[model samples]
Structure formats: structure tokens, C-alpha cells
Target: MYTVMIVDDEPKLRLGLQTLIPWQELGYEIMGTAANGNEALRVDEEQIPDVILVDIRMPGMDGLQLLQEIRRRGWDTHAIVLSGYADFEYARQALQYGVEGYLLKPVNKEELSALLQKLHQQISADRLEKQVHQDAKSPEWAVYSLLSGSHDLANVSIDNLAKSLGMDWPKYQIVLISFPGLHPEEDERIRSFRERLVTAYAADGQSLVLYFAPYTVLLLANTLVGDFGRADLYRELQMLSGEIRTHMDVAAGETVLALDQITNSFRTARSLLERSFFYDKGRVLTLETPESYRQAPSSSKDTSLLDGEEVSFRLYYLVDVGHAEGIHSLLDEVAAQMAIIGKGETEIRERFFYLANETLRKVSPRLWSESIYPGEPAQFLAGIYSQRFIRDLVGYVTAVMERLARCADYTSRDNEMRRLLDFIERHYYENLRLEMLAGLFNYSSSYLGQLFKSHTGEYFNAYLDRVRIDKAKELLTQGLKVYEVAEKVGYSNVNYFHNKFKKLEGQSPSSYQKKS
Candidate 1:
């Protein structure tokens, strides 16, 4: 309920105004009353009411002075001026003070009720606008949410989202944006700038949603009206980039897209973002068509090197020995062999893209996107374009491999850490406390704690909790009942399980199950 305050020198007038009006029906609570402006200001500071009714003519600080103080303090209270005098000059002064309405002395009940109704309508509209903005950041509402990772809405029904937005499926256009060389702070600034532009454009009936990621922002807008042409959109985007560059030195690129092909547009935008290394800085490159910007083939040979058992064995040998340089060299050799078989750089790139995607599909199917390459897929065959993004990926794979290798090492010194991890993973569903694991492994609990940390880089208890949580996630995803999942994950106490799940997953077990 919204709080309301009354300020009048006359006690009877204040009481009549308070008691005559059905404040509860009008969506307001009479929070406080004051006999002077100073008292009103004090209550306002303490209570911060949503609406304030003040007498215009008063001793010391008058209603107008109180209104000025409120404005100076940036308070959002809606003010209504009340006075015995209905002079035109008084009403004009109230208007100048940002008063929502003016009431003559002995205020009419009908007039007050009408004003309350109007305020209610305005508040409701504001709430609807906010809800709409939030919806735009979810898959059910905006395509931009997909590229920016703002929402894991891959499973959301698009038809439901369209219905909520009052948009036809074919009426939307997706614009994928990329910002290179942006730090977290710079990314925030750029995001704010883009939101402002979207707000301005939306004033003309264009609905827009902005989604931000580490290095990119995506915009999804309903452009079915065709009021704004493609060239106009491009010009506005260029202007926005120029404004951003004035504040921060960075390169921003965008790719406009039709609704049905948003996933492809996102890939095109990402590829363009990466290409900034090869181009001039602070350029707003737009991928109107990906086919037109295809690169020339690499000078690698064409040969089916992977088809030979000897080559396969040698490649695996290099990888097994932790020779990253050797693995890269072997890949280069394979690329060269393929070039010799009359395969252009484009052809080799296409083959490698297919191979890499297929490998990832098997191991991490959840991360795969339907639109792997944008524009014309054939154009992506020029070279393995995603090589630059593989550094972190390779490092991760190497770490996992190193951990597994340590588990397989012949030395007893390192075997304890591996054994602890293996034991935890295998027996997370049992009441396997730290002391139990320590005794089973023939080590003191304190010594085992230090060993686990030195090996896994995490505390023993934390590691165990992580293992249990991961197992719980797997069980929950398989449609286990909440209580059953709790028991299966070794948490016999349902309350404890729910609390732990919430603490780790940021949601309750039931909520996570519903979402999955």
C-alpha cells in the first residue's frame, strides 16, 4: 500500500480531509499528519510518503517552500497543494512547484478520488513498462538474450514469447553487436549508451531489447512496421559507435539480421569482432552479407593424413606427452598435406570446422549452437577462424589432462591426492565424512586436508560438497523427486538438502527441477 501524508494548520480541516475520503479504497494509507511545514518535512524524511497534501498558505516555511526542499532532495513524493484561497495566482504557483493537483480549502471528496484514480493508472502503466523491459532480456521475449547469455532460455517456447510481446513471429529483426578490447567498466558504459539509443528509437513505436555479454551486446527489435529502413538503422548504429568512441577507445561492430536467422547473425558478429585485430581501430564494421567478405585460402597441402594409422599414433603420442608445440606442428603438417590434395584453405577450414564441431558435439553437446557459421557456410572454409579462441580452451583441456595424468602416475607421493578425489566421486552418496575418508586412506584428518588442498587447490570439505552438488544436479536433471534426490545425494535430512541446494545453486531444489 502507498503511504500518504497530510499537512494543514487547522486540525478540523485535516481530520475532515482524512476521515471523509476512503483512503484505503483509494490505495493509500494515512501515515502522518503535521501542523506546519517543518513538521511535515521531518515526517517526510522519516516516512517518505508516496503522496503529500500540504496547505499552500502557512507560517514560516509554506507549501511551496516545502515542495522546493523536496525537489532539491530528489524525493519522488507526488505533491498536491491545498489552500482556502482558490486564486488563479495560487494555482499557478502550485503548478510551478510541480504539484500534481490543487485543492481549494475544504477539498471536494470527488476531486480527490479522481486524482487518486489517475495516479493509480499512471503507476500501473509504469509497472507494465518495467515488466516489458525485463521480458526483453529473456528468450521468451527477445532474441538478443540468446547471444548475450543473459538468459538460459534455449528451451523457452518462442510462440509464448511472441504472444506476450504482442508481436508476430515474422515481424522481428535481430541485430548482433560486438565490442572488442573492452574492459568490464567500458562494457558497462557501452551498454548504457546502446540502451539510451534503443529508448530513443522505441519512442517511435519500435520495441528494442539490449543484451550484454563479456565482449558483445545484442539488440532484438520488432521492425514489422518497416517505418525505419535498413540504411537508417545502420546510420543510427554508426552514430552510436562514434559517441561511444568519444568516451572510450574501442572498436564496435554490428550485424543486422532477419528474425528467422538470428543465430547465424550472432556468429557473423562474433567473427567480425575477432577480425578487429586485422582492421583499423574504432571502426563500426557491419556485416550486411557474410558471403561478400570471404577470405582467400591458406597455402596448406591437401592430404588425408588422419586416415593413416601411423599418423594417428604419432599425433596421439605428441598430445599424450604434453607437447603442445608438437601437437600444433602436427596440425600444421596435416593442413599442408590437405592443401597438396587440391584442397583450398577454404576447404580445409570447412573440414576442420566440421571435425571440431563434431568433436565438441560428442563431449559438450550442451554448448553447441545450431548456427555454427553465419552467412554462407562455404565462406567459412577459407581458414580455421576460431583458432584464436582456442587458447583458453586448450589450457582447460590440458589442466584436465594433467589432473587425470596425476591420477595415473606411478609415484606414491602424488597418488594420495588422486585417490582422495576418486574416493569422493565414487562414494559421495554415502556418509563419507572427512574423518572417514582419512581413515580409509590411512592418513590423519589434518594431514589429509592439506594433501587434498595441495593436489586439488581446494579445501577437502569444499571439494566434497562440490562433488555432492554435481551429483545432485545430475540426479535432479534425470527427473528424480526432490526427496528422493536428497536421499540419493546422501543428504537424508530433506531440510538440510534444500538449504544446501539453495546455497549452491542459487535456487531451491524444487525450483531447479521445475526450470530443468
Candidate 2:
């Protein structure tokens, strides 16, 4: 369907045109409505529509100036001016910028429909004429045009183009090859497999070879001569990749008996080659691999398989325990797995940023004090996001991890132990438990229990009960009810709270408040 946009200064006119016009019945959908020229320009930058209806007599940046700027910017969108009886002079100058025509302020439905029908027919006819002109250039251009979807895929057109090029091949398949870290303008393969193509398939110079940078596409023209199939093609491509110590994917689709199917085969091969991230280097990826490997979203990441927070916690724990070898191995695994799931560079950067900013900072808070991620937190987050590639991002994150592993004893020392006691003293009215602290501090529950007992001369639960009872006594002395003070000190059952209070202070809550 054709997309359209309306630009006018009056909000009422914009709404009237949007609701009153039968745009969908006229083979168009209003993509957006803009109240000014500046707003219209910003909308078109994201997605340009096929046609635009703009007002001629607006306040700032009138339709004539908007049309002129559209022309100067080479937008190439068909524009129609909304003019009144007094603005005929401005409408006349808009024609010089290739506007379709001008419409009166109170536009009639018949005039707009006729102009749109004429423009649609002209657009379709011009596209077909351009394709026919490109198809008749040469034998190679005709073959390339057909493979690249420039020509209309009519059976008669394909037969005629094949006869004119003096070709009789009945089978075709596409093989896509890519060199990850090399210049595409220069190819350094042994050409042995390409020689095999000439001997078995396209005997003449009929093989359509095209280079789509970083990838070389081979549109193989086959006959009924040899038993060469896609499996044999992959075997030969593997040998070539192994000898050169480089990586390539032999992602070939099934052979087709029609020339029109070459486009589908080409697209399929390109999609499958993206799955090579799961395989090792110096090998090929076949059609046997599954299409997707990304995991589903979850909140708690301890059980999740592919969440970025899993890596965040794992790195922090390993750094806390001083496992140097485990940290290095995890860094490599994360990069490879993200590549396999088809994550772009931007997504990889954000994932690594969570690891650095949220989890790893707790281990060594001063870890980049003379920091790469300096200034405010926004500057620190942007520092991780400024990397241009996966290797550079991995290198930066690796440096941070190595630095953290050396200086990661923030919570393991005596002063930090005092800090933990201060944390409990500050948040004792809330529900506090040793298991929660173990997870937050990346320590074992049993180990943390023993440490708390040695430090405070009481078990973790008994110490928490005493802290809560002391706060409850203060609230009771301030004329709070027994049940009110019980709930305020983190107790849902007042009876259970009374039992704990009597055990700790040798008195019931009502008696304690009366004595105070």
C-alpha cells in the first residue's frame, strides 16, 4: 500500500483531513500528521512516505520553503501543495521544485483522487521500463539482473533472456562464502573448487560470480552431467578453508530447476551462513544446525542459561574467590555464545556494561579510580558503549576483569566487616536474614553464619530478634499500642512477636510499655 503524510499548521485542519478523508479506500494509509515543517522533516528522516500533502500558507517555514528544502535535500517524495485563492503565486513557484500540483484550501475529493491515480500508474510503469532497460544491456548484466531480482520474474522473460545469452542449463543453486577478516576486493583462494564447478556444471563462462563485500556469491549453473550435490559442494569448500587457515561457511540450499528460484536460494544461503557463529573456526556450517539459540527472558538469572546477568554474577563470584583461570575461560565463552545467538555489537556492549557497573564494582570499588570510565555515571556507561567491534569490547572488559581480580577484597577485610555491621544497624527494622546477606556478599550461608557468631557472640537469628525488640521498646514508650509496635518492628503475627519479646526481655509487650 502507498503511504502518505499530512503537514499543516492548523491542528483542526490536520484532524479534519485525517478523519474525513477515506485514505484507506483510496489505496493509501496516513503514516503521520505534522503541524510544522521542522516536525515533518524529522518524521521523514526515519521513514519517507510516497506522497506528502503540505499547506502553502503556514506561519513559519511555508509550503514553498518546505518544498524547496525537500528538493535541495534530494528527498524525491511527491509533494502536493494546499493553497487558497490568494496564494496562487506561491503555488506557481512550487511547481519548479517538481511538486505534483496544488490543491485548494477547501479541497474536493474528486480532484485528489484523480491526481493520486495518475501518480500510481506512472510509478508502476516507470519501474518496469527501468528493469527492461537494465536487462538488455549485456549477457552478464542480464544474468546478474535476474539473480539479483531486478527483472520481473515472468517465465517468458526468463526463457527469452536465457536464449539470448546462448545458455541451456536447467538447474541452479547458490553458494555463499565469506571471509571474516579480509578485504573483499582481493580473494586469495586456491580456485580448485571453482575449477570443479567449470568441469561439472557450467561448462562455458556461464557461472554468475558476484562479490557482495565480505561475501562472494556463486550462482552455480548446473546440468544433468555429474552427481554433484550440495553435500559435495560443502566437502570441497571445507578443504579450501582448512588449507588457507581461514573460516568460511558452505551454506548452500537445494538446487532448483527454474531460474526464478535462484533468488530464494540466494536468500536462504545468506540466512544460514549467519549460523556459523556456533561452529569452530577453519570449518564450514551446513544446513544441519538449528536456526536460533537465544534464550527466553527471566527475572532471576541464577537459573537462566544465556542471560547477561548470569555472566555478571559469575564474574563477580570468581573474582571474589580468586579463580584466575575461571575468569579467563568465562570471558571467551561469553563472546562466542553471544555471536552464536546473532547479537550485534551494540547489544554486546550493554551486556558487558551491566557486568562492570552493577556487579564487579562491588568487589573493587576503587578499581578504576584513575578510571577509563571516568566523570559521571553516564560517562562511565558511555565508555563501555563506545567500542566499535566485538574484539575491542572483549579486550576492554578483559582488562577490567583482570584489574578487579587483583584488587577484589573489599568485603574480605576487617574494616569492611565493620561496614557490614553498620549495614545491619541501619536496616534492622526490615526483614533481615543471613541467607540474604550470603547471596548479596557472594559468600556461603554456613560460612557467613560462623563469621557472624564469632563477631557478635550470638547466632544470626537471635541477634536479629534482639535488635527488633530494642526498636519495639522505643516505639511502645512513645505511646504506641502493643500490636502497632509489633507490626512496626517487622512482625505480622502479634502473638508470635509477644513470645519473642518475652523470651528476650522477660516481660510481655503491654507490661513493657506500662513500665516505660
Best by TM-score: 2
Per-residue accuracy of model 2 over 1-516 as CA lDDT, tens digit each: 567889999888888888877776666789998887777888647588778999987777877888888888888588988876656578679889888878887877778888876776555445545554765655545655665566554556676666666654678777777766543333345344444444543456556554433456676665212334545655666654544555455566557776667777777777766645433333334454443234322322333325776667567755654444455556655765676666765666677788767654565456545335445545656677655445556666776666556564445454544645655665676666777566545568999889889988998888888889999999999999988988888888999999999999999999988998
| TM per prediction | 0.29, 0.45
Q: Which ranges in model 2 have alpha carbons more than 4 Å from their true place?
A: 1-132, 135-150, 157-259, 269-372, 379-458, 470-498, 508-516
Q: lDDT per residue, candidate 1, 75-107, as tens digits?
A: 878888898886989889778878889878678
Worst window of 10 by summed lDDT in candidate 2: 296-305
Residue 80 of model 2 has an lDDT of 84
TM accuracy, model 2:
0.45
lDDT score, residue 323, model 1? 33
Instruction: Estimate the TM-score for candidate 1.
Output: 0.29
In candidate 1 the C-alpha lDDT for residue 89 amounts to 91
CA lDDT of each candidate? 0.58, 0.66
